[model samples]
Target: DIKILQLSLRSADLCIESGTLDLSLKILERAAVRVERLEIFSGDDDVPIGRTLSAKYYMLRTLLAWHQTRPDLAEHMLCMIPEEAINNDLQLASELADLCYNVGQQAFSKGQFDLAAKWLEKAAKHNSRSLNAGDENSPNVKLRLIILHMTVRAYLEQNSGESRTKSLQTLEILISYYPNELAVLILWLEVMMKQGNPDHRIFYNRLETLVHVIELTDTNIKIILSYIQKLQEWSIEMCVRTLEQLLLRMPVLSDNEQWIDRLFVISIRLSTSSGVADSLSLLDAVATHLYDYLMKPLSQTTANASLIVRLGINP
Candidate 1:
């Protein structure tokens, strides 16, 4: 009940701040009833209410009473509550975490890393605990935890090398367990590249394994291909570098051409429909290299002109 009142107060505060006075008043009035129930339940005994209950009511009342005159006090009180208390109340925990996450992201965008770090960490932790409270082994829960850890690591990277290393290690372990996890793999590759470690060969080897898995499975090849294409679209440097290396190593021209054509088509569609052109030059470079190596000299011969034309390109 007390947790419900806390939620009501939070909503009321938001409504008031946004000038929805009617909604705010209704929520506040409902919260008042909950507060009265809390007081009655606690009774006139010398003993106090449970710590969690007290904290909930305190947070609700303090937030409800917030005004310009005592804004600092309210803020301080709000911050004083232990974040762990939120873990016991899942609904409130999720709401508060989301609010903090949004505020943190805005602060990050505004170049307030210190402030952003504090709020984002809180949000991540709350979400993590809420997820963990249920099934720790659930795929969705694990993914959320990975995201939270990643967010915290990003914030800590600016301040501590140890934190960054630890986060990277955690990601490495996760990828080892879930090799098909493309999102985690992408971030792991980025982190490895950023570290500038000569041991990056290991990550490349893992990537090769992933590609082989896609080839073997045939069932999700399209999905796996889409992931690779997204990675290429993410950056020109990555696209050029990865494709160049793949072309150097892979002897199967037909397979490589199929993959390249898919990525190129996707890029063109993105550019035409959304006006978001990225790494087109890189695509052109790879395509030019492939065409020059596979088609140009062949097209120079009269017998091969028909072959080149059959491949849907001008000879």
Candidate 2:
């Protein structure tokens, strides 16, 4: 009976491959009936046999759903297969891993972030298991890290308490893998800020060290400016300190337009909010710096005009 059921399923597979979905469905239905009858007739209750048959059945159904362009149905069918069954079949495991990543990306593009996170989490698990963890240079390992990063982003977009917590945990794993990576560190900083982690100052210091070593590129500048804005709400004192450090290095920055604009806004806002002498002094310093920047070119023009006047042609 078991052999008959397998042959019936194999016939269904051939039918499916030949694009005879109706015939395939009929054969699959017959196989399902046979499987139930075999259980009754054999009286052995072969759980492994049943599970293997079920996995094959669901996988074929999933393939048919794909051929029909019913992605929703395909994903549903895949979910119906038990994990143990998938794990027992190497090909099934590989197919599931790839499918999970694709579906996760599709869900993310559709703004279904929670669903994206769910699928991507599965992809990460499969990829991590298949790839050697210690081989950081492996392309597959890099892909796994990317999947994990996407998972973090998906959880972040969901922004629920549970999702934020999940994002934070994923970020921690990513940071462990690439400790000096700017994007991951910044993301971690944001999640910690949102969670109101009291230990943020430590992380902030770590970010500061990384950025300083990397030497104030546009990317670094953008993240620092973005962060200091948010940090102001948490601690104005720390915000001022960071701004001071940035301002001290102003001459070294390649592009200061955005920096100067936001710095002015932040300085004015903080000075207004605190209404204290120290805040006002910081504001004054910012104004003076801005004046120097704006006036430097004018001063050069003035010097050129004075030289022309002294040449004294009176034409």
Candidate 3:
């Protein structure tokens, strides 16, 4: 049965390569069932043939879903494989990574960002082997960078803590590659905010300092403002603290006038969106704070601001 299943897997792969996935799917599904039978005896692991069959089954399932316009399902199928099993098997890792990297590209083309992020993160998790000892300009290396970039884009759309934390390593590598990329810097700020309450000053300081950098163009500023809007929706209190901290740091970082004017621009947009009257607008809170920042800069430091030491103590 093992021999028959192995033969069927090879034939199924040939069918796949020949652009006959219908036939390939049938063969692979049957072979998968047979593989399960073999697994019952081999304890489902570490036996070379059994592991090979199991990996091939899941990998083909992923591909079948990928080519069928079910990228979300493809991602889910791949995640069904145990990370430990994939990590220990080179063939499994490569197949999984390649399938996901391709699926992410297709998802990006269709603007399915959430699905793209899930697959791209899985691709990033594995397949470093192609990049591990190769030329930096190799096709695989370029592909990995492209995946990393798209993963950042997709992660931005979702803005979840788990995805942000999972992406840190690849993101740090990307940041090193594009040191001045504003989007990457924005992602770093979000990660810092979620890292811990004790590190809030560090987040505010980096955000303030980075905004003063030459890369903070109108588009990037808009992106940060949008993030602030989401933060407001997610936690009104944290949003207020962010605005207050940014106002406090603006004076030391650059001309306070410029930052205040930017806030006014953002306030106009927020007003336009909500059609709120001027008397009770969001800017009123900011307006009052603006007065405090201008009139009593040293007197208005919040307890939160005073506690943070601005990158002096690492998070």
Candidate 4:
């Protein structure tokens, strides 16, 4: 019976190849019935064989749906395909990734961003699974990056705080893997500004450090300035702290004429508009307290130290 089913599957495959989709569909329906029957009587040795047959059956159905231009159905069939089947077959995995990406794009174009993000994330997962050990510059890597970028875009287009938070989480994961990635860093900063959080001073410090390492393009400079503008409006003290931190790193960033000029302009604005001269003492006091807490040893001036010193007199 299994042999008969195998032959039937081959016939169905050939019918599909010969462009007889109707015939192939009929044969596949029969094969699907037989697959269910096989599962019922499947023994230990027949289990893998049964799974292989089921995988082929699902794959053929997916292809048929794709051929008919029914992407929604095709995606459904692909979802039914077992993970073991996909992992064992590179071609199947590639097909899955391609179809998911196309479907995601279609959804994105129709303004269904939530659906788009779902499929795009699927595409990214499958595409990344195929990465080779030394293929950093390979086409697959580039494709994965594009997929992830689109995923983030889809999440952001919803214009809700929840969606922006999702985008930030995605960018955070991306930055962990590609720390010096210019686009990821810029997008991360943009999302931070959109979130309107005043606790982004640490991230600003990180940005200053990144500038010393990665060359800032004009676009990067523009986004950084926009972020600063928003931060200044929201919390001038944070903006001042961030500017001071960047100023400390000026020895390295000063080589960029555009950046240095912008930094000086911002500093002048702070000095002129914000009474930065008067607040210098307050900032200095806060800085000293932080420095002493972080740098100075507690044991040196603690009661424990006095007790230890007095022990020698007692003994």
Candidate 5:
């Protein structure tokens, strides 16, 4: 039975590689029968043989079900496999991770956001469980990034709160690894804003790093606007200060008019709001800067200048 099982496994793999789904399913069906007759059950991570092999077997079965267009069956087959068995086998875990990630992304492309999120979460579990944190080289960082980003995107599409939580956790680890990466930094800020009442200081502190990011793309501008709105509610003074720092860091002569006016209006709201009665001068400083750069011809020369000015002027 073991000999035939090996032959079936090998033949099924070849069939899968050769695009012969029916043949692969037939081989896997035969293997499943022989394996079931042996009555092997999955066991603890340290335990080998029966249980571990069963997990691998089920994984193959799951793949066959997937190719057969039976996602329900594929999902069920995957659920039956003990996570430990896959986690202990790095190669198996990575393969499963890739498979699930691909399926999730495919689902996302089709606008099946909720299902995409579920599959990506499963992929994250498979990859994370196998990751040997103590070993400097265990988890492939690139794959980890892909999983985190896709999962975050899935949640964002659904407008679910999990995007903020999952991405925040992943961002902490990812940021130190890719601090200078513009897209990741922007994402981190957006997630920071989405979080429910995270310490106001978190956004303020993030600005210390992110404000210097040169490109003021529309997405980044949206995140900045969100951050400013939150800061107004939390501390108008901090909002003004952050805006000032951002302007200083911005490339000279930006021309993004929309945001320049938006920022000026936010500053105006802050100044008029009751909390900053004694600090109207702070608002004045912000207003003056906006008028000098955003409304003037000098600021409209480049996208950078336009963007910088756009945030300064009010409608």
Candidate 6:
């Protein structure tokens, strides 16, 4: 049991660093097995130590499994967490919220919009309650709320006509309440584009405001750059699509020379950083496509080259 516990802890640390949720859950299950074995060996006589440990193990295992798969199960387990379990157990509560957030995310990924909404709403409410009760502010809680807003926006994207109008109204409400969430803003831009009725000027203005509000200190820059680099590595197509959307929408953005220059530099850097020849070649092709748009005369250009450049396209 001790060996399994040590293995689980090590795996959890690695998974957390690498974002390997599935592997982490598998290790956690092993730990849970050991905990169960220990409980059985200690006898089911309702001893205080055994019961307490059982509850703790069950909570952790349930949370970990939920993070990997069905969140509803996690929610059920959350209700079982003893009040005594959380008296000084900030870690336990935080873990529960994190699991709930993952459940919401899994539902969103599976396109179970209603279920996703419910789970996310519950997670957000739980986090808020914890915060209001003077629990330490968990960054995970804020992140979950941001994701919930994003999922809500995504759900609205599939509707049409009157339903679309209703979705937009709901999205606007969410945005109004979480105005400072960058992920929400980004998703809102995406939703607007998907609707084919984006207010480009307003969107760009908001993005600009967000960029300014974000600190550009060395540490912040490093983190932002790392994120950009990771995205470039993991999903070049996404980067290209984002650029394409920006170009298609923001006309005045082409006039932003500084932003355009920075984007070009970033693209070049990313292209070179990618060691794979094929990946670099693909990036080059994207650069060329972007260039064609940028070089076109403003009178003839249907898309904004400057915006593309700002998004790390060469053109």
- The candidate that wins on TM-score is 5
Clashes of each: 0, 0, 0, 0, 19, 1
Error of 4 at 202 (Å): 3.9
Q: In candidate 6, what are the lDDT values of residues 127-163, reduced to their tens digit?
A: 5444534333657556645655745654574464654
lDDT of 4 by residue, 46-143 (tens): 87777777777787787677667676887788778778866776655666677678778878988989978988888888886667768788677777
Model 5 alpha-carbon drift over 4 Å, by segment = 1-11, 17-19, 33-53, 82-84, 135-139, 155-199, 212-226, 251-315
What TM value does model 1 have?
0.48
Tell me the whole-model lDDT of each prediction, alpha carbons only: 0.52, 0.68, 0.63, 0.67, 0.68, 0.55
How well is each residue in 112-207 modelled by candidate 5, as lDDT tens digits? 888888888888777776566665455555677777777777777776566646556666766766675666666776776666676787667776
List where candidate 3 sits over 4 angstroms from the true fold: 43-46, 128-140, 155-172, 177-315
Which candidate, 1 or 3, has the higher TM-score? Answer: 3
Model 1 clash pairs are: none
The Cα error of candidate 6 at residue 56, in Å, is 3.5
What's the CA error at residue 159 for candidate 3, in Å?
Answer: 9.5
How many residue pairs clash in model 6?
1
Per-residue error (Å), model 2, residue 195? 3.7
Look at candidate 6 and tell me the lDDT of residue 311.
59
**Model 4: lDDT of residue 252:** 46
lDDT (tens digit, per residue) of candidate 2 on 1-315: 678878887888898879999888788777878766654555446766766777777777776676566778877887887677666655556556776787788779889898789879878876765564466676666666678889999998997889878887888788887777666676677766666544757656755655554567766777787777676666666666666567546556645555555555565556557545565555455555545755553234333332332343221
Which residue pairs in candidate 4 have backbone atoms (N, alpha carbon, C) closer than 3 angstroms, thus clashing? Answer: none
TM-score of each: 0.48, 0.54, 0.48, 0.59, 0.62, 0.41
Residue pairs with backbone overlap in model 3: none
lDDT of 2 at 161: 87
lDDT of 1 at 198: 32
Give a tens-digit lDDT track for model 1, residues 274-295. Answer: 3334444444555456565555
